[model samples]
Target: QENRITTVQCLSGTGSLRVGGEFLARHYHQRTIYLPQPTWGNHPKVFGLAGLSVKTYRYYAPATRGLDFQGLLEDLGSAPLGSVVLLHACAH
Candidate 1:
């Protein structure tokens, strides 16, 4: 079997976001990027500079000290088709 995935290399975290953001800005039809609220502080600036509009979805809920799954679903469910979503790496 042949690998079908194509990956671009870049430094981790901020660097990766920057590169990915730039790529999306150049090629993706939708320019809006939705990130989880309370995500890494650098996310907005990174995607903003890459020319995408940054929007936030609910994530952490302090009352339970955990993810607010309902709110997250509500937010994502309303996103326009083809909008880029920024999520944390599984291990992060």
Candidate 2:
């Protein structure tokens, strides 16, 4: 007897992330998706096309041009349970 495993690879990080998000939106009970403010330009459109309502959470602080740690945490903490959140592997 022999055992075998197969794996499939999507394009790259971005492609994989998008595919995963779309899958969740389609199969899971996800209705709303929260994105970081000043995230990649295409993020909102991508999620919207996948049938998930897109919203933004505070991410960057214009005053410092840096990450808004406190605001980000607060927004996440306030979001409804089970809401999908999109995080970037690399800050845009």
Candidate 3:
């Protein structure tokens, strides 16, 4: 059995996100992508332009000035099976 993986070097974050979005748009069964509520400003535009439906999952809580952990879990749990989620690992 042969499993093939192809990798492309991306020059920047936005570019990488766009490429990833495009790949998912073509190969993923679920077309909707879940982004964090308080994500980078250009995230929606970049993913949307790459042909994926953009949706938000709870992330930051402005009132508390911290992560909405429970809200995030609930939002993600409610997402359709196989939906793509973009997680920001560090500060954007």
Best model number under TM-score: 3
In order of appearance, the predictions have TM-scores of 0.88, 0.78, 0.90
Off by over 4 Å in 3: none
- Shift of residue 30 alpha carbon in model 2, Å: 2.1
Stretches of candidate 1 off by over 4 Å are 1-4, 90-92
CA shift at 76, candidate 1, in angstroms? 0.6
Q: If both were scored by TM-score, which would come out higher, candidate 2 or candidate 3?
A: 3
Per-residue error at 40 for model 3, in Å?
1.2
Give RMSD to native, each candidate: 2.7, 4.3, 1.5
- What do the candidate models score in CA lDDT, each in turn? 0.89, 0.82, 0.91
Residue pairs clashing in model 2 are none
Worst 10 residues of 1 by lDDT: 83-92
